[model samples]
Target: MPLHLADLVARSELHLSVVAAPDRLDRPVEAAHASELLRPGQWLQGGELLMTIGLLLPMTEEACRAYVQDCAAAGAGALVLGLGRELPYQEAPAPLIAAAEAAGLPLLTVPDEVPFIAVTKAVFAAKAAEQHRALERVFDAQRRLTAAAASGRGLTATLEAWVDATGIAAAVTDLLGRPIAAAGLDDLDPFGPAGLPPAVTELVHKVAGRGLRGSASSASGSLGSVEVQPLGANRLRGLLVLVGTLAPNDRMPASGLVSLLSLELERRHLADEPERRRRSALLGRLLTEGVSAEHAHDVLAVAGLASDTVRTVAVDPSGTSAEMAAEVAADLALAVPGGLVRVHDGLVEAVVGDNLDLIEILSRFASGAPAGIGPAVPPEAATGSLRQARALVAVSRALGHPAQTREAHSARLLLEFGDRRALRGYADAVLGPLDSADPTGDLVRTLATWLDTGGSWDETSRRLAVHRHTARNRIDKAMRLTGRNLDDGDDRFDLWLATRIRQEMKAPGT
Candidate 1:
């Protein structure tokens, strides 16, 4: 409609002749621009009606053929050549016309009496009229959409009406990868095969990164597809995919309706963010309170989790920067499927279903992030295991090292053993120097025995079959090695705790 070659020729009232093909009328003319140089193809933009005179190049068969090929590659809708006294105008240039015909470049010869200005003016006038009509249609659609929106009609309904009016299919989905509503194809389910295609799903997944609107095939075996535009902030909301099969492409739906739909969708999502946050909070509480698996499933149903069975993983950061901890958690969440939420004090809890790989999940969590990981547990066991993971975090802090336990029970054991300051001291006293100096064998046996005997030196000496003085000296040496004062009453408690830790560490296959 925007000034096609036929329209230009009709308006100019010039004796036009097509020296080129009679069969190239199928191509749509998008716009009109003029170029007079021989190598105009270098500066050529596609979908234009290029105007020129054969003045810049030699009138030879090879030159004409090369020029036509360049016009084809540059996507010129049609070529208009002006005949004048400078170039021989006795008859149509057979070689140039033949080359143009072969290359599918529609060639229109301009009369010597018709000024190029008249041709340019006619094309501009036609284009302006077409643009004005398009704008009127767009304005009417916008008004109807605004009215529907003001009447408290939901986004999906408004979108449906818009699509119906524009004759294109439209759909809306949420960030969780579920379609909320759709129009045009009543038989197809936009969330799955009956509606949108896998390629559309992939595009929607990437919509968060950029604004997207392009054509794609339908999963319903339709010959043509639609242009999907991601809506909402950060393009996190679903998308508005316009499906149609018009010849030159439907401008009303693709451009006008799509723009309005994106704006409305973005507004809806912005208004819904607070409610979404509230729902997230409620779901988090449900996950933390040891809900039954069925209850968890129901909660997930409300939250729109796309899986039935799920695994729970807990992450804890000890002695690391909080920023680093958050980045690790965020990266891990993005790398996995299902939903991930950060709950209460640097704890990142995720619910993954059986569909995902356990080892790869764990490896990705640990990669490029230094943090303690708790073992994976089933979804229903998440609450208890999460608590255990917290306990293990405490143990890691107390021991000044990274620690991991696969289950709640094991984590609890490690946490209890690590909590005793005296056991830590005793382990340091006996094993510390030996482990550091020789890096082999255990020397914490006497300390473990002493603590087991309730810190009674006489009983400990008898157990070891040594003099009480020797046992006292050994205790003193151990205390000194561990950098704790044994003579203090407070140090006795510390020694008792440290001795317990040594016993646990020395346990078989610990």
Candidate 2:
């Protein structure tokens, strides 16, 4: 048992006379420290039972009053005065006792025969015993936590051990503010006024700001108090809060247990982060690489992401590896309850519920790269939707606008007309005006006719009613007009696709 004022008083063998408010005696003497001076402005360390004999001051009433005022200002846990030498030993100086009472400092009268050293020794012995017991409890808690970790027990078991050791309730919440683990009192609500008492909330907010641990007590009448700490690497994980009701008269521990717990939680979280990232990466890779629907489903099941609906999206800036892709994919997966996987380089496939908000989910991925989102189809359509998303991405890249969406049918049009060859042509056509002055009229028309004839000079001549040589001359002239070569493999592919695309536009329903 920790030392209390009553214990100290009994041990000191002093006449137990309570002066002023006797109720203040209930406060614990948490530690053993003695101060004999009377400095008015000096701050008193909490829980210390201060002793004085009035030997340093005059015996006047004003001097006695000033001494009491100093004890109050210092917030001395209790004040013990030795009587009989200068002032009469039988009774406490009235003015001094009155001042001590007014200041709310617990005052104890010591007879001249009772040595102050005896009181200090008794307090010290009691504190030493308390420390030993606290150490035993801490060791027991640590052993249980180690066992739980080795056995792969969930967070709750570890929390339970801590609670049992400290006589406090422990709660672990995720970044989303949901409790993932808790132990001890079930009636402790975290959301209500009674649950997250004002002092605890203030302490949590303060700790959050500094990325450190903090604690606070409720108003004097509240049931219990709390301590809040940020746990995990980079403090990305949520908080761990410990709530407890301490015996009003028992000494509070001063051995930095709260700080130690914060370090332990952070260490564990850091150890787990790499493995979590690895698993997320594996899930992402399996989804993005065009895996069969059944295979993808198996992978999702393995990753604990089995869902009935999915949406596929293709991302650009293709150098992103599986790991980087996975992080983004995980964020998307968390945005919704269902599982998400990566299907290919820069492509993420997510199996989300029907009610999942598409805009918010996609927006998170968009922050990382230029992305083309396919329709939010069901899981059965994942493969097809992934292909559609790829097609949409191709169109976006070809048109130099990375995320625009045309009508629903636009994907099909781009799929049919925006192949790699078509993109080269579009690039040329768009770039042609920069290369030559009359590209729009001359180069575009000749290119169109040649494509209409299927790249054959004789056929093109027949369609245009010109000689083969003349048709060849027109084609060559058009390439020159666009400042490009028609015969080069890259140039030919570009011209052919661009010409065909332009002709298609002239046809109905372009």
Candidate 3:
């Protein structure tokens, strides 16, 4: 229990007496401080018991009232006015007492014979004891949680320990809020037929969607106050939902519990990593190379992906790695329902039952990098889809955003399967003159725009935000570089094809 203003007055040895707003004596006193400054509120935090000698107090009644109001506004637990020697009167001034009463500020009087040191000592002693007890609780909770985890009880055991320590119904859930472990709230099925109850569902969204690490609650009956806490660092691994409102003192333990649960969950993922790799390898082979429908069906079954029609998504690698690709694919599979992801040919590939928003999911984990997607296709046609997705990857990089195969307009299919070395050599041969003079890519942008607009200078200028004369000048320079006549349809078509091939290979126009 916190010390209150009445507790100090009740101490007969202290020689303190209440003079104003005695009814509000129950307010908790966080600490007792002595100040002689006119406006001590500048240094005073709330919930403090402010003790002062009358030497620095204003002589005017109105000034005294303002002084009292300042302390109250600063959230002082109560004001203790010394009433002898330096005091103008034997007791608190009439205006000061009246102001305190109006503001519901508790005011106490200390006789000059009693020193302020006694009050300060008592407050410090109580605060120290409270802190010691809080530390004890935290240590005890940590030991129990560690013991339960070591007992091979898994996440469920740790959650049970949290319930025992905090006396609240607690649960661990996946990103989608499906309960993986629970205690004290058997009736609250986070994955029930109707899914998590409305109250719990709303709180889960707030925590996961907003990336809130602190507790969030819903004020609903039966469900009561539900607190949702996130459970990972860097990226959210899962959620921790407590059914009842936690005590103010239990907040620290709740955070520690989240840390412990995150470690245990990560350990579990590590233990299963071997099997995940095997699954990723199989899926990778199936997507990059042509596989018979029957053979693909068998591989998908073994990988736990039972989808007949799956959408292929391609993520351009940040760096090359088969292991990194496998890890990312496995993580995506766990995050999404009924999905298989793998790394094939230095790219991350995901196949999902539905065309789930891989962009949104990747944003949660790996943002800033664009992804390419192929339209949904039959399982046997995965290689064809991967080919299309590969093409979209180039398109995506060229457009500086995510792209889908269905939206592709260039000769992407031929570009994706062609020999890379041969294509780069051809591009350099065709656009070398332009690259020599225009290394800033201004000419390349102009050429791309002119080709896209079907040689319309007006539309090209509008698209590029340039004047008509500027667009024509750029086109003239590009034509001179390539030594092609813009008026000749054959020359224009050849340059357009070369530009398309260059974009697909991610090579500069040169």
Specify the highest-TM-score model's number. Answer: 3
Question: Each prediction's TM-score against the native?
Answer: 0.49, 0.54, 0.62
What is the Cα-based lDDT of residue 507 in candidate 3? 55
CA lDDT, candidate 1, residue 335: 50
What TM-score, to 2 decimals, does candidate 1 have? 0.49
What is the per-residue lDDT of model 2 for residues 1-510, given as tens digits with 9 covering 90 to 100?
A: 666787765653655556655778777786545555657336566677776676665656777778877766666677777666554355666777777777777888777676677777777778888888777765666666666544556566667666665677767654333456677857655445344555555555555444434434443224355656676443334567666664432223312333334455555655656655655565455545556667766765766666666666666645666666655565454445545544454565544545655554454344435566666665546657766767677665554444423423533355444564665566556546634655446446655677756687777777767788876776677666666775677766666556555555556875
The whole-model C-alpha lDDT of candidate 2 against the native structure comes to: 0.59
**Candidate 3 on 163-192: residue-level lDDT in tens?**
888788887887766778888876764536
- How would you order the candidates by lDDT, starting with the best? 3, 1, 2
Give the Å shift of residue 453 in candidate 2. Answer: 36
Taking the candidates one at a time, how many backbone clashes does each contain? 8, 10, 0
Misplaced by over 4 Å in model 3 are: 35-43, 52-67, 81-103, 111-113, 163-255, 281-303, 362-372, 390-392, 401-403, 409-510
Sort by TM-score, best first: what order?
Answer: 3, 2, 1
Using lDDT as the measure, name the better of candidate 1 and candidate 2. Answer: 1
RMSD of each: 11.6, 12.9, 10.2
Find the 10 residues in a row with the least total lDDT in model 1: 364-373
lDDT of 1 by residue, 112-171 (tens): 787677766666677778878777766676666666556666776677667655776667
Best model per lDDT? 3
Which lDDT values do the candidates have, in the order given? 0.61, 0.59, 0.77
**Displacement of the residue 116 alpha carbon in candidate 2, Å:** 2.7
